[model samples]
Target chain A: MQKIELEISFFGAFRKYERTGPLRLTLAAGAGMAAVKAAIAEALDPAASDLLKVSALADAQQVLSSAHVFDTSAQLVLLPPVSGG
Target chain B: MSQSPDTRSIHVCVRETHLSLEKASAFVDAGENGAALLFVGRVRNHNLNKPVSGVSYDAFAPLAETVMGEICVEAQAQFGPDLRLYIEHFKGYLPIGGISVIIAVGSPHRAPAYEASRYLIEELKKRVPVWKKEHYLSGDSEWLDGTSLVENP
Candidate 1:
């Protein structure tokens, strides 16, 4: 059994937790974004689950599809629904 | 400004300081283009019926800049090739009446200029990776509701 750690950065309403710095998410090796989301849902307060369900996940370059899988540790960003003009 | 060096028709950026409408106006100025439309979005003092003191914007700068450039290209494609566009969104805390965003469009005709300007602002609101937190006069703060980027929950 192998494990991977992801550093998750937060934005928007999620910034409340961002002050603690990037959250370290642990997942099984070969896990995908769905797993990552579930892990985060478990790690944070239940109140944030509603927002998490609607948020988008990204790496350094671009947003990731739910199907995106991880083979190595990575730095990820969480984007809640955006409202900028 | 991050733009194509050769054409220089499009300029898009997310600044940590402040955005200048005058500079945006100058960037889109062209002799052949008869219409230049500039739209500046300012931070107001209230939101959701609550009085606000100021706002702080958080942005994923790299991705925001990329999406903004794509939007400028889309506007040009729909409007006309000769269009010049400028978009700048501010980062950090802004006091009431501060400038939050600016969109400038220069087109060969007034019609396209107006259409493109509207399109840029609307799309920027929905697509950019930026968020705002409103600090209230009551000493509370909250993030405003926004358009969801996820396809399915």
Candidate 2:
């Protein structure tokens, strides 16, 4: 199994949930997006996975949906829809 | 307030207690416009058949400003050289009949100014992160989902 570094941002109501560092998880190279999200949930809180509407980005652009697969060196960020005015 | 020749447009805030037509007009003049269209959105005393007293608004400032800037960029792209626009929205408590939002657009002609002004206000109401807390005269208050109310969420 290889390790992947993920950067996560929590906004709006979720900001109150985790004020500190992003959850870092190590997964196999061929892991699916769902599996990676589940790993993050396990590291954070199980309820977080349910509350979060996640969007993954490759590089600084291009929004990736859940159907995409993850590679070992891929950079990922998890952000929930910010509920604001 | 000072003027800059390089800045043909401006955005400013007026206290709820004191709104000035002069300052707002200056922004339009600064843009060297032949026509200016301004939209003032006020708080009504009643809403949806219910009595209303006041309202409060809150926002994530950085994100809100970024979003507003994006709107301006989009307006520029859509309207091209014919339009210059300014938008101002009040946060915190606003009493009945108080102006809550202001949008001003300037153009060489009234058509683009009017069209852009309408577009700016509609898009801002749809996209901006300024949430309102509606207060009723019956002693109840509720936080309104701004985007949701505009059918953009």
Q: Which candidate achieves the best TM-score against the true structure?
A: 1
Tens-digit lDDT track of model 2 for B55-134 = 77654454455556566666766775546667767766878887777778778877888777777777776655556678
Instruction: Quote the B-chain TM-score, candidate 2.
Output: 0.82
TM-score of each: 0.92, 0.61
Clashing pairs in 2: A85-B129
- Candidate 1 lDDT over A1-85, as tens digits, reads 6888899998889988776799998788899777889998888889999999999998756778888888888998999999897
Give all candidate RMSDs, comma-separated. 2.6, 7.3
Tell me the lDDT of model 1 at B94: 94
Clashing pairs in 1: none
Q: lDDT for each of the candidates?
A: 0.88, 0.59
Looking at model 2, what is the TM-score of chain A?
0.66
